[model samples]
Target: MNDVSMPYETHGRTGQKSRTRTALVTAAREMVANGQTPTVDRAASAASVSRATAYRYFPNHASLLAAAHPETGTQSLLGDDPPDDPAARLDIVIRAFTTLIVETETQQRTMLRLSLEAQDAAPDHAPLPLRQGRAIGWITEALEPLRGQLTDEGLHRLVLAIRSATGIEALVWLTDMAGLSRDEAVDLMRGSARALLASALPV
Candidate 1:
Protein backbone atom coordinates (compact mmCIF):
# COMPACT_ATOMS: atom_id res chain seq x y z
CA MET A 1 0.00 0.00 0.00
CA ASN A 2 2.84 2.38 0.85
CA ASP A 3 4.49 1.50 -2.43
CA VAL A 4 1.30 2.41 -4.26
CA SER A 5 1.62 5.85 -2.72
CA MET A 6 5.17 6.17 -4.04
CA PRO A 7 5.95 7.07 -7.63
CA TYR A 8 6.28 3.87 -9.63
CA GLU A 9 9.73 4.73 -10.99
CA THR A 10 11.19 4.80 -7.48
CA HIS A 11 10.23 1.20 -6.63
CA GLY A 12 13.58 -0.51 -7.24
CA ARG A 13 16.16 1.68 -5.47
CA THR A 14 13.79 3.50 -3.11
CA GLY A 15 16.27 5.62 -1.18
CA GLN A 16 18.15 7.61 -3.84
CA LYS A 17 15.33 7.36 -6.38
CA SER A 18 12.76 8.50 -3.83
CA ARG A 19 14.93 11.51 -3.01
CA THR A 20 15.19 12.33 -6.71
CA ARG A 21 11.43 11.98 -7.19
CA THR A 22 10.85 14.18 -4.16
CA ALA A 23 13.24 16.74 -5.59
CA LEU A 24 11.33 16.82 -8.85
CA VAL A 25 7.96 17.10 -7.12
CA THR A 26 9.30 19.76 -4.77
CA ALA A 27 10.69 21.68 -7.71
CA ALA A 28 7.38 21.43 -9.52
CA ARG A 29 5.57 22.69 -6.43
CA GLU A 30 7.99 25.58 -6.14
CA MET A 31 7.29 26.55 -9.74
CA VAL A 32 3.57 26.32 -9.15
CA ALA A 33 3.92 28.49 -6.05
CA ASN A 34 5.73 31.04 -8.19
CA GLY A 35 2.85 31.07 -10.72
CA GLN A 36 4.48 28.93 -13.37
CA THR A 37 2.75 25.95 -15.00
CA PRO A 38 5.78 23.75 -15.11
CA THR A 39 6.56 20.88 -17.45
CA VAL A 40 8.55 17.79 -16.52
CA ASP A 41 11.57 19.22 -18.30
CA ARG A 42 11.18 22.52 -16.52
CA ALA A 43 10.88 20.84 -13.15
CA ALA A 44 13.98 18.78 -13.84
CA SER A 45 15.86 21.92 -14.70
CA ALA A 46 14.60 23.63 -11.57
CA ALA A 47 15.58 20.65 -9.44
CA SER A 48 19.04 20.44 -11.05
CA VAL A 49 18.23 16.91 -12.22
CA SER A 50 18.37 15.41 -15.68
CA ARG A 51 15.31 15.67 -17.91
CA ALA A 52 15.22 11.91 -18.38
CA THR A 53 14.91 11.32 -14.65
CA ALA A 54 12.09 13.83 -14.33
CA TYR A 55 10.18 12.23 -17.20
CA ARG A 56 10.30 8.89 -15.41
CA TYR A 57 8.33 10.42 -12.55
CA PHE A 58 5.96 12.64 -14.58
CA PRO A 59 5.57 11.76 -18.23
CA ASN A 60 3.32 14.59 -19.30
CA HIS A 61 2.20 18.13 -18.51
CA ALA A 62 -1.13 17.15 -16.97
CA SER A 63 0.51 14.52 -14.77
CA LEU A 64 3.12 17.04 -13.64
CA LEU A 65 0.48 19.67 -12.90
CA ALA A 66 -1.65 17.09 -11.12
CA ALA A 67 1.28 16.26 -8.91
CA ALA A 68 1.66 19.92 -8.08
CA HIS A 69 -1.92 20.20 -6.86
CA PRO A 70 -1.85 19.64 -3.08
CA GLU A 71 -5.51 18.70 -2.75
CA THR A 72 -5.45 15.92 -5.32
CA GLY A 73 -5.04 13.30 -2.60
CA THR A 74 -7.82 14.58 -0.35
CA GLN A 75 -11.15 12.89 -1.15
CA SER A 76 -12.89 14.02 2.02
CA LEU A 77 -12.79 16.66 4.71
CA LEU A 78 -14.99 14.79 7.17
CA GLY A 79 -12.84 12.89 9.64
CA ASP A 80 -13.60 9.45 10.98
CA ASP A 81 -16.44 9.33 13.51
CA PRO A 82 -18.04 12.44 12.02
CA PRO A 83 -21.01 13.70 13.99
CA ASP A 84 -24.59 13.21 12.81
CA ASP A 85 -25.58 16.83 13.59
CA PRO A 86 -25.46 18.75 10.34
CA ALA A 87 -24.15 21.92 11.92
CA ALA A 88 -21.37 20.17 13.78
CA ARG A 89 -20.39 18.16 10.73
CA LEU A 90 -20.38 21.31 8.60
CA ASP A 91 -18.25 23.19 11.11
CA ILE A 92 -15.73 20.38 11.25
CA VAL A 93 -15.50 20.08 7.47
CA ILE A 94 -15.34 23.83 6.91
CA ARG A 95 -12.47 24.23 9.33
CA ALA A 96 -10.52 21.47 7.67
CA PHE A 97 -11.28 22.76 4.17
CA THR A 98 -10.39 26.34 5.04
CA THR A 99 -7.12 25.28 6.64
CA LEU A 100 -6.19 23.33 3.51
CA ILE A 101 -6.86 26.34 1.26
CA VAL A 102 -4.91 28.77 3.44
CA GLU A 103 -1.94 26.45 3.77
CA THR A 104 -1.82 25.66 0.04
CA GLU A 105 -2.84 29.06 -1.26
CA THR A 106 0.02 29.26 -3.70
CA GLN A 107 -0.69 25.88 -5.28
CA GLN A 108 -4.40 26.69 -5.23
CA ARG A 109 -3.73 29.97 -6.99
CA THR A 110 -1.73 28.21 -9.67
CA MET A 111 -4.52 25.73 -10.40
CA LEU A 112 -7.04 28.58 -10.43
CA ARG A 113 -5.03 30.28 -13.13
CA LEU A 114 -4.87 27.13 -15.18
CA SER A 115 -8.57 26.45 -14.77
CA LEU A 116 -9.41 29.93 -15.94
CA GLU A 117 -7.07 29.61 -18.88
CA ALA A 118 -8.65 26.31 -19.82
CA GLN A 119 -12.09 27.87 -19.62
CA ASP A 120 -11.05 30.62 -22.00
CA ALA A 121 -9.70 28.06 -24.43
CA ALA A 122 -12.66 25.72 -24.22
CA PRO A 123 -15.93 26.80 -22.76
CA ASP A 124 -18.45 24.12 -21.71
CA HIS A 125 -15.74 21.56 -21.01
CA ALA A 126 -15.30 20.04 -17.58
CA PRO A 127 -13.15 22.35 -15.51
CA LEU A 128 -9.57 21.76 -14.44
CA PRO A 129 -8.54 20.31 -11.10
CA LEU A 130 -9.21 23.43 -9.02
CA ARG A 131 -12.71 23.86 -10.42
CA GLN A 132 -13.72 20.18 -10.34
CA GLY A 133 -16.24 20.69 -7.51
CA ARG A 134 -14.61 18.33 -5.00
CA ALA A 135 -15.61 20.74 -2.26
CA ILE A 136 -19.24 20.30 -3.31
CA GLY A 137 -18.97 16.60 -2.50
CA TRP A 138 -17.42 17.35 0.86
CA ILE A 139 -20.03 19.97 1.69
CA THR A 140 -22.87 17.72 0.58
CA GLU A 141 -21.57 14.94 2.77
CA ALA A 142 -21.35 17.29 5.75
CA LEU A 143 -24.95 18.40 5.21
CA GLU A 144 -26.24 14.84 4.72
CA PRO A 145 -27.99 14.93 8.07
CA LEU A 146 -30.19 17.74 6.74
CA ARG A 147 -31.66 15.62 3.95
CA GLY A 148 -34.92 14.88 5.77
CA GLN A 149 -35.25 18.47 7.02
CA LEU A 150 -34.87 20.19 3.65
CA THR A 151 -35.99 19.46 0.11
CA ASP A 152 -33.35 18.08 -2.26
CA GLU A 153 -33.12 21.32 -4.23
CA GLY A 154 -32.97 23.36 -1.04
CA LEU A 155 -30.22 21.21 0.41
CA HIS A 156 -28.22 21.35 -2.81
CA ARG A 157 -28.54 25.12 -2.94
CA LEU A 158 -27.39 25.41 0.63
CA VAL A 159 -24.42 23.19 -0.09
CA LEU A 160 -23.52 25.29 -3.11
CA ALA A 161 -23.78 28.46 -1.07
CA ILE A 162 -21.49 27.11 1.61
CA ARG A 163 -19.01 25.84 -0.96
CA SER A 164 -18.97 29.17 -2.79
CA ALA A 165 -18.07 30.99 0.39
CA THR A 166 -15.44 28.52 1.61
CA GLY A 167 -13.48 27.80 -1.57
CA ILE A 168 -10.28 29.30 -2.95
CA GLU A 169 -12.17 31.93 -4.97
CA ALA A 170 -13.61 33.41 -1.77
CA LEU A 171 -10.29 33.09 -0.02
CA VAL A 172 -8.60 35.11 -2.77
CA TRP A 173 -11.14 37.87 -2.40
CA LEU A 174 -11.04 37.93 1.40
CA THR A 175 -7.28 37.94 1.66
CA ASP A 176 -6.07 39.64 -1.52
CA MET A 177 -8.80 42.19 -2.21
CA ALA A 178 -10.26 42.72 1.24
CA GLY A 179 -6.76 42.79 2.77
CA LEU A 180 -7.65 40.38 5.54
CA SER A 181 -5.03 38.03 6.90
CA ARG A 182 -5.31 34.35 6.03
CA ASP A 183 -6.66 33.49 9.45
CA GLU A 184 -9.23 36.26 9.18
CA ALA A 185 -10.22 34.99 5.75
CA VAL A 186 -10.64 31.47 7.06
CA ASP A 187 -12.79 32.69 9.98
CA LEU A 188 -15.05 34.66 7.65
CA MET A 189 -15.47 31.62 5.41
CA ARG A 190 -16.43 29.48 8.38
CA GLY A 191 -18.96 32.08 9.46
CA SER A 192 -20.34 32.21 5.96
CA ALA A 193 -20.71 28.43 5.85
CA ARG A 194 -22.58 28.40 9.15
CA ALA A 195 -24.80 31.29 8.14
CA LEU A 196 -25.71 29.66 4.85
CA LEU A 197 -26.53 26.41 6.59
CA ALA A 198 -28.64 28.21 9.19
CA SER A 199 -30.56 30.18 6.59
CA ALA A 200 -31.63 26.95 4.91
CA LEU A 201 -32.88 25.28 8.08
CA PRO A 202 -36.39 25.55 9.63
CA VAL A 203 -37.21 29.00 10.91
Candidate 2:
Protein backbone atom coordinates (compact mmCIF):
# COMPACT_ATOMS: atom_id res chain seq x y z
CA MET A 1 0.00 0.00 0.00
CA ASN A 2 3.00 2.25 0.54
CA ASP A 3 3.63 3.26 -3.06
CA VAL A 4 5.87 0.27 -3.73
CA SER A 5 6.15 1.34 -7.36
CA MET A 6 8.60 4.01 -6.32
CA PRO A 7 12.17 2.84 -6.72
CA TYR A 8 13.51 1.14 -3.60
CA GLU A 9 15.87 3.78 -2.21
CA THR A 10 17.80 3.46 1.00
CA HIS A 11 18.72 7.09 0.94
CA GLY A 12 19.22 9.58 3.75
CA ARG A 13 20.49 7.00 6.20
CA THR A 14 23.69 7.22 8.19
CA GLY A 15 26.11 4.28 8.31
CA GLN A 16 24.82 2.90 11.63
CA LYS A 17 21.12 3.20 10.68
CA SER A 18 21.77 1.55 7.31
CA ARG A 19 23.53 -1.34 9.04
CA THR A 20 20.65 -1.65 11.50
CA ARG A 21 18.11 -1.72 8.67
CA THR A 22 20.14 -4.36 6.77
CA ALA A 23 20.34 -6.49 9.89
CA LEU A 24 16.59 -6.23 10.45
CA VAL A 25 15.77 -7.17 6.83
CA THR A 26 18.16 -10.15 7.05
CA ALA A 27 16.50 -11.29 10.27
CA ALA A 28 13.05 -10.93 8.73
CA ARG A 29 14.16 -12.95 5.70
CA GLU A 30 15.54 -15.72 7.91
CA MET A 31 12.26 -15.96 9.84
CA VAL A 32 10.23 -15.95 6.63
CA ALA A 33 12.43 -18.73 5.18
CA ASN A 34 11.78 -20.74 8.33
CA GLY A 35 7.98 -20.47 7.93
CA GLN A 36 7.34 -17.63 10.38
CA THR A 37 5.83 -14.23 9.80
CA PRO A 38 8.26 -11.92 11.54
CA THR A 39 7.47 -8.83 13.53
CA VAL A 40 9.68 -5.79 14.05
CA ASP A 41 10.30 -6.80 17.65
CA ARG A 42 11.18 -10.37 16.75
CA ALA A 43 13.50 -9.33 13.93
CA ALA A 44 15.05 -6.69 16.15
CA SER A 45 15.76 -9.28 18.80
CA ALA A 46 17.10 -11.66 16.22
CA ALA A 47 19.43 -9.02 14.81
CA SER A 48 20.39 -7.76 18.27
CA VAL A 49 19.28 -4.37 17.09
CA SER A 50 16.94 -2.36 19.34
CA ARG A 51 13.22 -2.58 18.64
CA ALA A 52 12.92 1.18 18.25
CA THR A 53 15.39 1.16 15.36
CA ALA A 54 13.70 -1.82 13.73
CA TYR A 55 10.36 -0.01 13.88
CA ARG A 56 11.99 2.94 12.18
CA TYR A 57 13.07 0.67 9.32
CA PHE A 58 9.81 -1.26 8.79
CA PRO A 59 6.74 0.43 10.23
CA ASN A 60 4.39 -2.41 9.24
CA HIS A 61 4.39 -6.17 8.81
CA ALA A 62 3.52 -5.94 5.09
CA SER A 63 6.51 -3.72 4.41
CA LEU A 64 8.85 -6.10 6.19
CA LEU A 65 7.48 -9.21 4.54
CA ALA A 66 7.46 -7.61 1.12
CA ALA A 67 11.08 -6.69 1.58
CA ALA A 68 11.77 -10.28 2.54
CA HIS A 69 10.70 -11.50 -0.92
CA PRO A 70 13.78 -12.45 -2.97
CA GLU A 71 14.74 -9.70 -5.42
CA THR A 72 15.94 -11.78 -8.37
CA GLY A 73 16.01 -8.84 -10.81
CA THR A 74 16.63 -11.50 -13.42
CA GLN A 75 15.13 -11.10 -16.87
CA SER A 76 15.46 -14.72 -18.00
CA LEU A 77 15.32 -18.08 -16.24
CA LEU A 78 17.73 -19.59 -18.78
CA GLY A 79 21.25 -20.32 -17.67
CA ASP A 80 24.46 -19.29 -19.49
CA ASP A 81 23.92 -22.07 -22.03
CA PRO A 82 20.37 -21.76 -23.38
CA PRO A 83 18.71 -23.77 -26.13
CA ASP A 84 17.45 -22.25 -29.39
CA ASP A 85 14.23 -24.30 -29.52
CA PRO A 86 11.21 -22.57 -28.00
CA ALA A 87 9.92 -25.61 -26.10
CA ALA A 88 13.38 -26.41 -24.80
CA ARG A 89 13.91 -22.79 -23.74
CA LEU A 90 10.62 -22.77 -21.88
CA ASP A 91 11.42 -26.10 -20.26
CA ILE A 92 14.69 -24.66 -19.01
CA VAL A 93 12.87 -21.66 -17.60
CA ILE A 94 10.26 -23.79 -15.83
CA ARG A 95 12.92 -26.02 -14.31
CA ALA A 96 14.93 -23.08 -12.94
CA PHE A 97 11.78 -21.31 -11.73
CA THR A 98 10.45 -24.39 -9.94
CA THR A 99 13.83 -25.07 -8.34
CA LEU A 100 13.87 -21.56 -6.88
CA ILE A 101 10.27 -21.94 -5.69
CA VAL A 102 11.11 -25.21 -3.96
CA GLU A 103 14.22 -23.75 -2.35
CA THR A 104 12.32 -20.75 -1.00
CA GLU A 105 8.88 -22.29 -0.72
CA THR A 106 7.99 -20.69 2.58
CA GLN A 107 8.90 -17.14 1.58
CA GLN A 108 7.18 -17.53 -1.78
CA ARG A 109 4.00 -18.79 -0.09
CA THR A 110 4.03 -15.86 2.34
CA MET A 111 4.35 -13.38 -0.51
CA LEU A 112 1.51 -15.07 -2.39
CA ARG A 113 -0.71 -15.02 0.71
CA LEU A 114 -0.04 -11.32 1.27
CA SER A 115 -0.78 -10.50 -2.35
CA LEU A 116 -4.04 -12.49 -2.27
CA GLU A 117 -5.18 -10.93 1.01
CA ALA A 118 -4.39 -7.46 -0.25
CA GLN A 119 -6.35 -8.07 -3.46
CA ASP A 120 -9.31 -9.58 -1.53
CA ALA A 121 -9.31 -6.59 0.83
CA ALA A 122 -9.36 -4.22 -2.14
CA PRO A 123 -10.04 -5.47 -5.62
CA ASP A 124 -8.54 -2.37 -7.14
CA HIS A 125 -4.83 -1.42 -7.14
CA ALA A 126 -2.87 -4.56 -6.32
CA PRO A 127 0.76 -3.64 -5.57
CA LEU A 128 4.31 -4.86 -5.75
CA PRO A 129 5.59 -8.22 -7.15
CA LEU A 130 2.08 -9.43 -8.14
CA ARG A 131 1.17 -6.54 -10.43
CA GLN A 132 4.82 -5.92 -11.29
CA GLY A 133 4.88 -8.40 -14.24
CA ARG A 134 8.38 -9.76 -13.57
CA ALA A 135 7.36 -13.38 -14.23
CA ILE A 136 5.49 -12.32 -17.33
CA GLY A 137 8.64 -10.78 -18.74
CA TRP A 138 10.69 -13.84 -17.90
CA ILE A 139 8.12 -16.16 -19.47
CA THR A 140 7.85 -13.96 -22.53
CA GLU A 141 11.62 -14.00 -22.90
CA ALA A 142 11.68 -17.76 -22.53
CA LEU A 143 9.13 -18.05 -25.33
CA GLU A 144 10.82 -15.40 -27.43
CA PRO A 145 11.33 -17.75 -30.37
CA LEU A 146 7.55 -18.00 -30.73
CA ARG A 147 7.11 -14.27 -31.02
CA GLY A 148 6.95 -14.37 -34.82
CA GLN A 149 5.28 -17.81 -34.94
CA LEU A 150 2.14 -16.81 -33.04
CA THR A 151 0.08 -13.67 -33.12
CA ASP A 152 0.80 -11.23 -30.32
CA GLU A 153 -2.48 -12.01 -28.62
CA GLY A 154 -1.91 -15.74 -29.00
CA LEU A 155 1.57 -15.53 -27.55
CA HIS A 156 0.26 -13.45 -24.66
CA ARG A 157 -2.38 -16.07 -23.94
CA LEU A 158 0.21 -18.81 -23.95
CA VAL A 159 2.38 -16.87 -21.56
CA LEU A 160 -0.51 -16.37 -19.18
CA ALA A 161 -1.43 -20.05 -19.35
CA ILE A 162 2.12 -21.02 -18.41
CA ARG A 163 2.18 -18.48 -15.62
CA SER A 164 -1.15 -19.69 -14.23
CA ALA A 165 0.01 -23.30 -14.27
CA THR A 166 3.18 -22.53 -12.28
CA GLY A 167 4.32 -20.23 -9.41
CA ILE A 168 3.77 -20.15 -5.66
CA GLU A 169 0.01 -20.68 -5.70
CA ALA A 170 0.41 -23.89 -7.68
CA LEU A 171 3.40 -24.83 -5.54
CA VAL A 172 1.34 -24.33 -2.37
CA TRP A 173 -1.59 -26.42 -3.57
CA LEU A 174 0.68 -29.08 -5.07
CA THR A 175 2.59 -29.60 -1.85
CA ASP A 176 0.09 -28.65 0.84
CA MET A 177 -3.30 -29.94 -0.33
CA ALA A 178 -2.31 -32.30 -3.14
CA GLY A 179 0.24 -34.10 -0.94
CA LEU A 180 2.99 -34.16 -3.57
CA SER A 181 6.63 -34.41 -2.62
CA ARG A 182 8.81 -31.41 -3.50
CA ASP A 183 10.35 -33.24 -6.45
CA GLU A 184 6.90 -34.47 -7.50
CA ALA A 185 5.49 -30.95 -7.41
CA VAL A 186 8.37 -29.64 -9.50
CA ASP A 187 7.88 -32.47 -11.99
CA LEU A 188 4.17 -31.74 -12.35
CA MET A 189 4.83 -28.03 -12.69
CA ARG A 190 7.34 -28.57 -15.47
CA GLY A 191 5.02 -31.09 -17.15
CA SER A 192 2.07 -28.70 -17.09
CA ALA A 193 4.20 -25.93 -18.57
CA ARG A 194 5.51 -28.15 -21.37
CA ALA A 195 2.00 -29.50 -22.06
CA LEU A 196 0.63 -25.98 -22.34
CA LEU A 197 3.48 -25.03 -24.68
CA ALA A 198 2.95 -28.10 -26.85
CA SER A 199 -0.76 -27.34 -27.12
CA ALA A 200 0.06 -23.86 -28.29
CA LEU A 201 2.81 -24.95 -30.69
CA PRO A 202 2.36 -28.54 -31.68
CA VAL A 203 5.18 -30.74 -33.03
Candidate 3:
Protein backbone atom coordinates (compact mmCIF):
# COMPACT_ATOMS: atom_id res chain seq x y z
CA MET A 1 0.00 0.00 0.00
CA ASN A 2 1.22 3.51 -0.81
CA ASP A 3 1.28 6.33 1.75
CA VAL A 4 -1.37 8.69 0.36
CA SER A 5 -1.28 11.19 3.27
CA MET A 6 1.38 13.33 1.57
CA PRO A 7 -0.27 15.08 -1.38
CA TYR A 8 2.76 15.76 -3.58
CA GLU A 9 0.88 18.19 -5.84
CA THR A 10 -0.42 20.22 -2.91
CA HIS A 11 2.93 20.14 -1.12
CA GLY A 12 4.83 21.43 -4.17
CA ARG A 13 2.25 24.13 -4.82
CA THR A 14 2.30 25.23 -1.17
CA GLY A 15 6.09 25.62 -1.23
CA GLN A 16 5.91 27.72 -4.38
CA LYS A 17 3.09 29.78 -2.90
CA SER A 18 5.08 30.39 0.30
CA ARG A 19 8.08 31.72 -1.64
CA THR A 20 5.85 33.94 -3.75
CA ARG A 21 4.18 35.26 -0.58
CA THR A 22 7.49 36.12 0.99
CA ALA A 23 8.51 37.95 -2.19
CA LEU A 24 5.28 39.93 -2.27
CA VAL A 25 5.57 40.92 1.39
CA THR A 26 9.14 42.05 0.89
CA ALA A 27 8.12 44.05 -2.18
CA ALA A 28 5.24 45.63 -0.31
CA ARG A 29 7.50 46.70 2.52
CA GLU A 30 9.97 48.26 0.12
CA MET A 31 7.19 50.06 -1.70
CA VAL A 32 5.85 51.47 1.56
CA ALA A 33 9.31 52.62 2.56
CA ASN A 34 9.60 54.40 -0.78
CA GLY A 35 6.38 56.33 -0.01
CA GLN A 36 4.09 54.28 -2.26
CA THR A 37 0.77 52.88 -1.10
CA PRO A 38 1.08 49.28 -2.21
CA THR A 39 -1.97 47.52 -3.63
CA VAL A 40 -2.22 43.77 -4.13
CA ASP A 41 -1.58 44.03 -7.86
CA ARG A 42 1.18 46.60 -7.42
CA ALA A 43 2.92 44.51 -4.78
CA ALA A 44 2.64 41.42 -6.92
CA SER A 45 4.07 43.30 -9.91
CA ALA A 46 6.84 44.67 -7.75
CA ALA A 47 7.63 41.19 -6.51
CA SER A 48 7.40 39.80 -10.06
CA VAL A 49 4.49 37.56 -9.07
CA SER A 50 0.84 37.42 -10.08
CA ARG A 51 -2.03 39.36 -8.40
CA ALA A 52 -3.63 36.03 -7.56
CA THR A 53 -0.45 34.97 -5.77
CA ALA A 54 -0.38 38.18 -3.75
CA TYR A 55 -4.05 37.74 -2.83
CA ARG A 56 -3.33 34.18 -1.78
CA TYR A 57 -0.82 35.47 0.75
CA PHE A 58 -2.53 38.70 1.85
CA PRO A 59 -6.31 38.40 1.59
CA ASN A 60 -6.87 42.08 2.24
CA HIS A 61 -5.26 45.47 2.69
CA ALA A 62 -5.24 45.04 6.48
CA SER A 63 -3.16 41.88 6.14
CA LEU A 64 -0.71 43.65 3.85
CA LEU A 65 -0.54 46.65 6.18
CA ALA A 66 0.05 44.39 9.15
CA ALA A 67 2.90 42.66 7.34
CA ALA A 68 4.48 45.88 6.05
CA HIS A 69 4.42 47.37 9.54
CA PRO A 70 7.05 45.40 11.39
CA GLU A 71 6.55 47.11 14.72
CA THR A 72 3.06 45.66 15.08
CA GLY A 73 2.68 42.96 17.76
CA THR A 74 6.17 43.54 19.12
CA GLN A 75 6.82 42.78 22.79
CA SER A 76 7.73 45.43 25.33
CA LEU A 77 11.31 46.61 25.05
CA LEU A 78 11.74 46.08 28.81
CA GLY A 79 11.61 42.31 28.29
CA ASP A 80 10.55 39.83 31.05
CA ASP A 81 12.27 41.16 34.13
CA PRO A 82 10.47 43.74 36.23
CA PRO A 83 13.47 44.83 38.25
CA ASP A 84 13.28 45.10 42.03
CA ASP A 85 15.08 48.46 41.94
CA PRO A 86 12.48 50.72 40.41
CA ALA A 87 14.72 53.63 39.49
CA ALA A 88 17.32 51.42 37.87
CA ARG A 89 14.63 49.54 36.00
CA LEU A 90 13.12 52.79 34.74
CA ASP A 91 16.44 53.83 33.29
CA ILE A 92 16.82 50.46 31.57
CA VAL A 93 13.33 50.58 30.12
CA ILE A 94 13.71 54.12 28.81
CA ARG A 95 17.08 53.30 27.29
CA ALA A 96 15.69 50.22 25.58
CA PHE A 97 12.70 52.09 24.15
CA THR A 98 14.81 55.00 22.94
CA THR A 99 17.19 52.59 21.29
CA LEU A 100 14.34 50.91 19.47
CA ILE A 101 12.86 54.20 18.31
CA VAL A 102 16.19 55.39 16.99
CA GLU A 103 17.02 52.10 15.29
CA THR A 104 13.66 51.64 13.59
CA GLU A 105 13.05 55.25 12.61
CA THR A 106 11.14 54.53 9.40
CA GLN A 107 8.98 51.91 11.07
CA GLN A 108 8.27 54.28 13.93
CA ARG A 109 7.12 56.97 11.51
CA THR A 110 4.92 54.47 9.69
CA MET A 111 3.41 53.37 12.99
CA LEU A 112 2.61 56.97 13.87
CA ARG A 113 0.89 57.47 10.49
CA LEU A 114 -1.11 54.26 10.83
CA SER A 115 -2.13 55.19 14.35
CA LEU A 116 -3.36 58.63 13.31
CA GLU A 117 -5.30 57.15 10.39
CA ALA A 118 -6.87 54.54 12.62
CA GLN A 119 -7.97 57.13 15.14
CA ASP A 120 -9.46 59.36 12.44
CA ALA A 121 -11.29 56.50 10.71
CA ALA A 122 -12.69 55.14 13.95
CA PRO A 123 -12.81 57.42 16.97
CA ASP A 124 -13.07 54.36 19.21
CA HIS A 125 -9.91 52.84 17.84
CA ALA A 126 -7.20 52.39 20.46
CA PRO A 127 -5.26 55.60 20.81
CA LEU A 128 -1.51 55.79 20.43
CA PRO A 129 -1.26 57.01 24.03
CA LEU A 130 -2.94 53.83 25.23
CA ARG A 131 -0.60 51.70 23.13
CA GLN A 132 2.34 53.60 24.58
CA GLY A 133 0.90 53.25 28.06
CA ARG A 134 2.05 49.65 28.17
CA ALA A 135 5.64 50.85 28.07
CA ILE A 136 4.82 53.64 30.50
CA GLY A 137 3.29 51.08 32.87
CA TRP A 138 6.61 49.28 32.89
CA ILE A 139 8.29 52.57 33.63
CA THR A 140 5.80 53.27 36.39
CA GLU A 141 6.49 49.85 37.89
CA ALA A 142 10.21 50.56 37.79
CA LEU A 143 9.57 53.77 39.68
CA GLU A 144 7.60 51.89 42.34
CA PRO A 145 10.38 52.28 44.86
CA LEU A 146 10.15 56.05 44.53
CA ARG A 147 6.37 55.95 44.81
CA GLY A 148 6.55 57.04 48.44
CA GLN A 149 8.80 59.97 47.56
CA LEU A 150 6.59 61.11 44.69
CA THR A 151 2.83 61.36 44.81
CA ASP A 152 0.66 59.43 42.36
CA GLU A 153 0.06 62.58 40.34
CA GLY A 154 3.75 63.33 40.33
CA LEU A 155 4.56 59.82 39.14
CA HIS A 156 2.06 60.10 36.34
CA ARG A 157 3.47 63.46 35.30
CA LEU A 158 6.96 62.06 35.32
CA VAL A 159 5.89 59.12 33.16
CA LEU A 160 4.38 61.45 30.57
CA ALA A 161 7.42 63.65 30.70
CA ILE A 162 9.82 60.79 30.17
CA ARG A 163 7.75 59.38 27.32
CA SER A 164 7.50 62.73 25.57
CA ALA A 165 11.15 63.48 26.06
CA THR A 166 12.28 60.20 24.49
CA GLY A 167 9.56 59.26 22.00
CA ILE A 168 9.67 59.02 18.19
CA GLU A 169 8.02 62.43 17.86
CA ALA A 170 11.02 64.02 19.49
CA LEU A 171 13.27 61.87 17.37
CA VAL A 172 11.47 62.90 14.20
CA TRP A 173 11.59 66.56 15.07
CA LEU A 174 15.26 66.43 15.79
CA THR A 175 16.13 64.36 12.77
CA ASP A 176 13.73 65.61 10.11
CA MET A 177 12.71 69.05 11.36
CA ALA A 178 16.05 69.99 12.85
CA GLY A 179 18.14 68.11 10.25
CA LEU A 180 20.12 66.06 12.72
CA SER A 181 21.71 62.76 11.73
CA ARG A 182 20.39 59.48 13.11
CA ASP A 183 23.33 59.16 15.48
CA GLU A 184 22.88 62.73 16.70
CA ALA A 185 19.13 62.19 17.23
CA VAL A 186 19.68 58.97 19.18
CA ASP A 187 22.34 60.55 21.36
CA LEU A 188 20.07 63.47 22.07
CA MET A 189 17.22 61.16 23.05
CA ARG A 190 19.51 59.12 25.30
CA GLY A 191 20.72 62.23 27.05
CA SER A 192 17.18 63.56 27.47
CA ALA A 193 15.86 60.26 28.84
CA ARG A 194 18.72 59.93 31.30
CA ALA A 195 18.32 63.51 32.49
CA LEU A 196 14.56 63.14 32.95
CA LEU A 197 14.93 59.88 34.84
CA ALA A 198 17.66 61.29 37.06
CA SER A 199 15.69 64.40 37.94
CA ALA A 200 12.26 62.73 38.28
CA LEU A 201 13.36 59.59 40.11
CA PRO A 202 16.40 60.75 42.01
CA VAL A 203 18.40 58.09 43.80
Inter-residue clash pairs, candidate 2: none
Estimate, for each residue in 54-90, the C-alpha lDDT of model 1 and write its tens digit.
Answer: 8777776666776677776688789889989999999
State every prediction's TM-score relative to the real structure. 0.78, 0.77, 0.60
lDDT of 2 by residue, 65-86 (tens): 6666764435567888888899
Q: Where is the poorest 10-residue window by lDDT in model 2? A: 1-10
Worst 10 residues of 1 by lDDT: 1-10
In model 3, which runs have C-alpha deviations exceeding 4 angstroms? 1-69, 79-83, 117-134
Candidate 1 lDDT score relative to the true structure: 0.82
How does residue 102 of candidate 3 score in lDDT? 69
Alpha carbon deviation, residue 50, candidate 3 (Å)? 13
Candidate topping lDDT: 1
Q: How do the residues 61-125 of candidate 3 rate in per-residue lDDT, one tens digit apiece?
A: 65676666644444555568666776567667777777777676776687567656767877875
- The number of the candidate with the highest TM-score is 1
Candidate 1's displacement at residue 126, Å, is 3.7
TM-score of 2: 0.77
Which residue runs of candidate 1 sit more than 4 Å off their true CA positions?
1-24, 44-60
Candidate 3 is scored at a TM of 0.60
